[model samples]
Target chain A: MFLALDVGGANIKASVFKADDAFALRSAKLHYPLWIRGVDGLPKAIEQAVALLGCDLKGASGVALTMTAELSDVFRDKKEGVDKVLRKAEEALGSFKVVTNDGSLLDPDEAVDRYMDVAAANWWCVGWLASLFERDCLVVDVGSTTTTITPVVEGKVAAKGLNDVEKMALGEIVYVGALRTPISSVASIVPVNGLWCRTSSEYFANVGDVNLVLGLLREEEYDVATPDGRGKSVEECHERLSRVVCGDRNMLRPLQTRLVARFVYEKVVEKVCEGVLQVLSRLASEGRYPEVGFAAGLGDFIALDAVERAGLRGVLLRDLLGRDNSIALTSASLALYLAYKTGVDVGRWISSLR
Target chain B: MFLALDVGGANIKASVFKADDAFALRSAKLHYPLWIRGVDGLPKAIEQAVALLGCDLKGASGVALTMTAELSDVFRDKKEGVDKVLRKAEEALGSFKVVTNDGSLLDPDEAVDRYMDVAAANWWCVGWLASLFERDCLVVDVGSTTTTITPVVEGKVAAKGLNDVEKMALGEIVYVGALRTPISSVASIVPVNGLWCRTSSEYFANVGDVNLVLGLLREEEYDVATPDGRGKSVEECHERLSRVVCGDRNMLRPLQTRLVARFVYEKVVEKVCEGVLQVLSRLASEGRYPEVGFAAGLGDFIALDAVERAGLRGVLLRDLLGRDNSIALTSASLALYLAYKTGVDVGRWISSLR
Candidate 1:
């Protein structure tokens, strides 16, 4: 049997397979979060890894790990963060062969910093989708506080200045989002009935909270931050988010909440699409819309915008990275499949994800 | 015989008295910033309260406007950053007025709709100094990325915040210093020589370029942007700031050049001061210092560390705000003697600079 895992600072996900049927590995992935201490996380992860393994220590033959954990900027000290996780992994999973970039099962120090770009998988997955589907495309990864876009050509990311924060017309880093973004960072005043109305910077903070007020977040499927792994009660989220604008939940109608979410999303979407278009247009000015790949946890959002904004067809990764049994939603998740297929050792830097 | 003035989006200050007098009739008060954009500031200022006149505006005659230019943020829009010196002061400044507790001059339509405890200042001068100084003090406001500190006592700035960036270690509002705070925002990898190592989040950015980097600035010097009147020098200012980062200033610093500036002055100073001293143990901590007055312009920096960190002996202000006519330095002219003294309308808000 063989197992492949994807770890992030916030969650760990894994997929399993039988050696003889490696191609038939389960399509789903398991996720768990790592507790980042004053700096220690490795030891705790080993315990979690054991529990994740489920079977006896000798049951599994090979394990592969692909990670985006190291790319996470949540830690105050990225180096120490990586050290703490790697130390714990070494102490506990001492017997298993570790995996990382450079196609080596070596010490954490020896691993290539393949996952240095926390958001790299989002673009890579988009690349995979384009190569598999044979289409031109763009990818937008709308995470908590920032949104990123990537364009692909001939199975490679063609965009220069991959991190495009310029082009305010494209909506540079709105600093507003569904989670983690403080509302005060949003507009001090919002457009109301075609006129700009001043709003208190203090009164509204965190678009996530605002989205909750508008009833846009589904309790069952969108409970990304709620405890117990269960989503927030829709009403509870709404009540809290409404406070961003006013003390009354009635301050926002269902449509208003969605508009706020859409506004935030559009601000980011405009930026991402503008970035992709900038790259595509620059290239197309020379000839044609080169075949572009697409990937991201929020691939669907990217795909739709790719169609409307860039007038390009996006290839769905499930068509390429998917086997019949798999169900995944992220480019990072898709990277596991890409890495498995290409043997790129995507998890090569798992030890560094503290 | 001198006058002191402190102007802001929501407030305006004017003080009058002779050098030999004890501020006989301090009467400058708060008013709308847009008012000056449309009319002669001096004439309009007096007209607003011609009926409520305290000290004679026409009688005292020579007026100095130390403004926190209300509504200048819009002109700065982070684009079209500047224009031919506003033929008329541009429209309403930014989305909101930066403010202190219990102080505001704008009307309901122009104010924020919500309340926030984001820890802001209407102006980064007086309160910043009051946070540190103890004895009567005179403050020399040589702002920009560079600021100079001169102590005053027995009617002067008793203590100085110097680089308000450092003063943050004292007790004051955050020190995301004036003049765009440079973009590199890089901090030194200090403590390397000691048993421990401490890394600052400050990237290589300067305070002057933050608002103008993306051309998102305007040349309205009479606002929250700067404490002085040099607006057209942004290109030169940016060039100077870009050169000091000590590396490829052309390339984005490894850390966020923009966001990190916030940490350098605001977060870093706060954290360091809190970490270094639990009680007031610094030089000015002795003898319950009285008189917590301060100067405007770069007074914010001096106020940063002096007030809370060392414990003020007392606060002092100068009849003059900067070292303009002093033997200290040139091009380092401090905007001396704000008119917000005398516990009147302007004084009420001056006390609330933090």
Candidate 2:
């Protein structure tokens, strides 16, 4: 059995596989907001996540780790952030394998030295999982705060950017996400009473409220804090979204606020679509074409929409992996790869999930 | 002696004046972030502010209060928010006089009953202060999170908007402020390496970093938390500003990041200028032209820039009032007004500050 941990800036996820099998026996994701908790709290947070997974750390044959938490601003830079996160992870779970962007596993000491390769590389596990399914494909993993678009060619990860800065420039990472994206950042000007009004620069509302108001997300899916620290009812969502334009429900009608929400939602979709097309064009120039696009994580539907807009066939990764496994795709993928490396019947195990 | 309180959504300010004098003996402003503390913590926060002022709440002859805290999202609606904030203030400082937008003072129960009149009326104090100097003038108070443009005509306040919603629509309130404004909200697309790159919707950078990079604001002025929770050094500011276009320091050169910061600063200036024009035109239509523009608050320089762009004689309220008093304009204004109403030598006191 192998245990995998995907530590992110805003969340921590854990996956545990059954003994001598590729099947994920248990998986859990929790919102720990490492930014607020600071780097020093990371070890206790990891312990809490392990407890949530309800598995004994000693029971696993090996522990595999992949992390994007270094991108969080608690550290001065990504290099320091990676070193600190690795140190804390070591304190929580002794001796583990860390995954780099190029799909190589390294010991903790090596990871610190080659911090740039290990920093913000959580998307690689998804690429590895997609490469196992198809030789030439693109995978988009949309979490709460960011989306990563990874391309695979000839049964290998073919991403042009190994780190965040390069990935952002190459359109491999689009920062708009399913939740926590400030509504004002999506569109500087929004239509209000037949006039385009400038949005407030305050963090008054986020995409989760926009999605909730537009019915794209259920209330339960908006598990993060509402921008106003209020409840997640549709009425409350409208009130929060109205503040994007510096107005409240008392100032805007329900239909008007809904119209604003729809506009923001469309802008978010356009942003992701822009990133998708940019990545595709970059790949096309290199004579590397993807046959299918795989969508995973909380914003799988968003990835699928962008893929369809790009005129490519799209499939939900959750349909191939189990629902729980897909939501926590990075850890699950790492665990499954470890199982396969250890001579488990991974192909049959994935077929069982399907 | 009188103690004045100006409670806001993100800050709580207190000012203390000596008996029969408009001179502010002591005043202070503290960042409380009511959304995080909630309504339950308002009384404690107010108590803390009073302590900051170095004055005993019971030693004051009377307490005068003007608040914009009701607009905070801790309560269900403005009415409930007003009631709760007033109740908390009463709990903190005992009985006090509440000032409404129309410049009327009432007891706590009456203020709650007329919540709409009292909600977000902190601008009235600034207007009253400006009217004392010039019969017809426009006063722009730019605080940390928002700007309020108030007009005083013929020695009386002449504001078209009584509350936040109307103020936003009428251009009396521009939600962009000196600090805490997300950079993405100022401009959706920024010039990045000769190509217009769409900004990331994440709260990666804010206006504070832009001003810091441009030398438009002193480092001490940027007291708010940065979007990345990093240090306020120029290099760190450059790194944060670069991320506005989804790029980091490694991807963008120093000049490139500075270019983005300049672009964002110009956009912020344009936004405030647009609101200034909107308010000026509305006044012109009503034939209530102001002869001068008075600028105040932490963003006094920003207000002066907007005033100059509007082709008006700009004067910093800090130059007129003492520097510390103008920084806490609303609370100081309230205390001075109360002293004047209670038979103080307000005219000589104004000259004393000058």
Lowest lDDT sum, 10 consecutive residues, model 1 chain A, at A164-173
lDDT of 2 by residue, A201-317 (tens): 899999998878877789988878777899999999989877888888788776667656656766676677667666765565354557598888788888887776554689998
Q: After superposition, which runs of candidate 2 have C-alpha atoms over 4 Å from their true positions? A: A19-22, A351-354, B1-354
Candidate 1 lDDT by residue in tens digits, A172-265: 2222334545544644433222222345455334545544544433343242454222336655554544454454455554333333333443
| Per-candidate TM-score against the hidden true structure | 0.39, 0.51
Best prediction by lDDT = 2
**Pairs clashing within candidate 2:** none
Q: Give the DockQ-based CAPRI class for model 1.
A: incorrect
Q: Per-candidate DockQ versus the true complex?
A: 0.01, 0.01
